[model samples]
Target chain A: MQRSPDDLTLSGDEQIAGEADRPFARSLPWLLLVGGLVGFAAAFTLTVEKIALLRDPDYVPTCSINPILSCGSVMRTPQAEVFGFPNPLIGVAAFAALAAIGAAMLAGARPRPWFWAGLQAGVTFGVVFVHWLIWQSLYVIGALCPYCMVVWVVTILLFWYVTLVNLGRTRAGRLLAEYHAVALTAWFLLIIGLITVRFWDYWSSLI
Target chain B: MAFKSPQNTTASGARAKIDAARAQDRRRAARKRNMTIVASLVAAFAVIVAVFLAVDPGSGPDGDTLAAGESRYVRSDSHRLTTAADGKVTLVEFLDFECEACRGMYPLVESLRKEYEGRVTFVVRYFPLPGHFNAERAARAVEAAAQQDKFEIMYQRMYQTQTEWGEKRTPADEYFRGLAQGLGMDMAAWQKAYEDPATLARVKKDVADGQALGVQGTPTFYLNGTLVQVQMQDDLKKAIDAALAG
Candidate 1:
């Protein structure tokens, strides 16, 4: 008996999902792996060295040249503490969670609904923190924390990736598909340019 | 022939059910998206509240004087010199007499003193930035007035009429004479005090004290003994609340 296109159906044995799912699932693994590695390394380095460097006055190991570029000057000030605690502790916990998330993604595990929600929460936190740190560095402390700045960059990238992936899985997939790559690249360049302009004086002084 | 017709009918029925299921899935996804947007907005609001609570612990029962201790001053001397008595919150200002920023901050300082009254004390210190040529001489003229208990009047008048006296048009001695007349100082005593080398040394000492406490620029204020780096009103309030709590 002949069948129409609407009526036709593959047998259970012949059914297979498309390559679209395969690529989409695999993309996350690479992102998580790289993000995890970078986050772990950056967090570990800052946690170990930056805190110790702050407590010691005579142990300046370069990087403290101009008044504005001086990490020692900024770190020594009371503005470094938001709630009587160093903000980098938040960074350590956040990066650690990101690394765990990345590992889970690498294992081919589909995140539960709560996992996506948690990720969205984290990205929001990161966005707030990055802007706060930038404001403090620019107008308040008038000096940048070198290692903390690196963490800020990585956190922003990780946030962008998480947002894109979440958007792709949800009903807003079309919006994500249209602007994800362009938005990410544009943001990356904008931040890099801002940092460059901020330290222009230090660069010129060296030259 | 009858079985063939029934089979076609069943096939069409199954196809219709499948289409309906897909449509339902699309509606469910849309609902989920709407829910997520609502949840995200709620979460954003919660975060803002949390941040506010985290930054400002609130003003306790101690009132404005306790709150004033947390305000950012330009330098520690501004606080130390301004406090009328031990345990009192003070707003100390270390200023260059010729600094434009200092001139601007003068009225704000005056208003704060009036507003806070006995709860806070306002102390003025000389911190002439080396870049301004006339700042040192201007600082000395104010110190000379302070010898006769007219420093505050002269200090305010110098800033009020900063354009006439602070810039290069008028000579330092001539400006001092003008300030003395405006403040109703005894001219003979004012002239003798203005020329006193000791008065200049006292102004120099205030500048030295400001530098020792990390005063980087003019119009620096010290709330209590802590060096304030930011000048925003909310930040100042937050610091004051924290100090009051302490």
Candidate 2:
């Protein structure tokens, strides 16, 4: 069913109008395409590694560098399977959906407001879940998994921009859209600082 | 008082209608703009990540960082495996006496020390974790043993009897004293050293050095200047062999 363009949520600013429309509209699909690929690769590899460990208990994950930086330690923890299945499995499905949605949008599919809303909800869960995983990794698990860190980085970026775009029609989103990079940089620095502090022993030692 | 013709009134009405028609295009235009901004945001983030990786000091595969220097590695000088520090290779271990992993790798390390006795200068540094009840005390006891030139004897003693007092909450000071007595160590001197603040200071310094070198857990080893990222015994051996070869 075709609706008027105004009916679609996440379609951004009215003031710029025809002057800036077509070029910007064409770039969303590419945005999703890049984020989805990196995120998918990280999840896919983690799942494969987990499966390998399960198949052979003696198998050491390639990412297990030491006691402080070990993927194998993270994978064995119960939190890695919070939903009674490996968390990376969820990442696989979500990233695929993200890529598909991006491709469709690129192909001129104008998803209803509900689709954007659902994506917002999903990524909200993702951002929260990943932060919790970061906490568990640093405070509880006492190790950093390389692939999982990649997922964490992408998930934060995905959630931030997703929320920004989804609120495209709102005054708040528009204002935020102006300083999008600043907010993202703040979020990145916070996480990076936390990681640096938590593994200070390891990080400082590197230098 | 100015006369308004029907033509003027009709023109005004048409202008309002045109404005109303333009309103319908606003949402489409808004979505287009938002998408573009979102896309640019993602692209910017990707660029940031790219820049970070480019400048990342530890840029090897699997996030393997470059090794720290050897200038500040040692503090206590008594716990070397070889008498002379003239060996081509210097292997440093940050160990906790009460750790199971340390206990597990003890025999392997002992054999490796024997195997590379002359070629490698093995240095042991105390890095007792807070969780282990007797680890710090054990380190002090070893330092005390070093006073009598019996550091290796105490080292072998603690690991050998790790099962008896390793994870126990009760202090193993009495058990350690018995071993020291059996080895003919002067009980008074060893006791005084155990209580010496200097003994604890030595452990703390080693712990700090280990942290500075990014060592988080016990039994962290460095082959020459590089941290040995060992998953198995062979990994340590391979690193050591490479250093020895070089």
Candidate 3:
């Protein structure tokens, strides 16, 4: 029943193919956990800043400068508190859930199928809000809130990581394995470059 | 006849093994279905997020109508006209004549005035910031234009040609006269009002009113008494609706 060395070589080739096919099978959990944790921290920080602003009118944080770099200028505007409530309340709730998911993942708990679906949904929401806030800051408000920019940058990175992790989990990994890492890194760099260009004026004006 | 036996046996064996191919097809179909479902879910979630962010949510009353005990205008000086028109919403704009942002906001105010004619009352108040050299003189010129019933025309002209008169190189009076001539105003009357000390006092009063209301910059607005911090059309409409409702 002993196979020849040529037969053994063929079997080894098949094993390697199988391993290559499931490339991200081991790393999916870790990716989601870390991405979610970073996302949650960024969102939580923004929520705290927004709450402090809401609690006190005269309490202008150090961010509010002249017409262009003012946090109060944009926050006092209608765009900041869409839905008649400060939009940061949504951030607080959603990011808290993300952080809990991250904790569960770190504790070696396998998320149910529904959890993956919901994470995808939440990340999509976060990405859309980030883009909208950027538009408001660039075009409408004509000002940039420095803390808000931090939230935006972190949201983009987390969204990209979550998307890659989700693709790696499902059967789609077979298709996405070709350039996942390269594409994700490229996207991250592009986003950072864009945000830098958008705030170029503020950067130049700094003393 | 001897060759037929082996060929027929092989053909029958292949027919018997066709079940495995059918099973493989079933597995492929299941995987396809799962992929489709996941793709649809992701797409649906994206659409929902886009819609939520796109919705404007309307404006709510979050701040005071005006900071406590603040006067609408600094003083009832010669230049200040207090007109009362019942049941119409009023829009009061405090603008610096030489400010770039104020210049940008000029046409929007004009368009709103025209669009909501008779339903809205529009008032212009001058708040020339001290930093800009020509802003005070330009405010005086605009006040003179008001005396000639050419306030709107000259206001538009100021923004339209802001760089020429406001920035440098030309005196304020000369620039105002050129703008007046361009707008077909009577030159003599325009000059008389431009030189009047009373007009300067009025411009100063406008600045005081703006400062009293915590107006830190040019192009500040008051819609029926609430200080409007943002200039979005939809938000402005919502604030107007609330004012009407009250």
What lDDT, from 0 to 1, does candidate 1 have?
A: 0.61
Off by over 4 Å in 1: A1-25, A61-70, A169-172, A204-207, B1-246
Task: Order candidates by lDDT, high to low.
Answer: 2, 3, 1
lDDT of each: 0.61, 0.75, 0.63
Question: Measured against the native two-chain assembly using Cα atoms, what DockQ does each of the candidate structures obtain, in the order listed?
Answer: 0.03, 0.05, 0.02
Those runs of model 2 whose alpha carbons end farther than 4 Å from true positions after fitting are: A1-25, B1-246
Clashing pairs in 1: B70-B239, B70-B240, B73-B221, B73-B222, B74-B220, B74-B221, B74-B222, B78-B92
Ordered list by TM-score, greatest first: 2, 1, 3
**Candidate 1 local lDDT, A1-207, one digit each (tens):** 333232223333221222123213456656656765676676666555566775653345355543445555555556656768766667777777777777776675566557767987887888777787777776655566666666777778777766665554343654653445545555665665565456443333232
- lDDT for each residue of candidate 1 in B106-208, tens digit (9 for 90 to 100): 6666666665565566677788887876687677777777777877777777787777766683346676688787778888887766654345545655665
- TM-score on B-chain, cand. 1: 0.61
Please name the candidate that would achieve the greatest DockQ relative to the true structure.
2
Q: Which tens-of-lDDT digit does each residue in A19-114 have in candidate 3?
A: 222335345456546655665665566567677876865455567664345676667778988788877667667656666776676676665546
State the lDDT of candidate 2 residue by residue for B1-246, as single tens digits.
222334676776785466447653654665566667656766775576556545664432112343443344553352786632465788888999999999988898898888888888888988999899889888989889998999998999999988998988777888888888988999999986775544655566677667878889989988777888879878877887899788
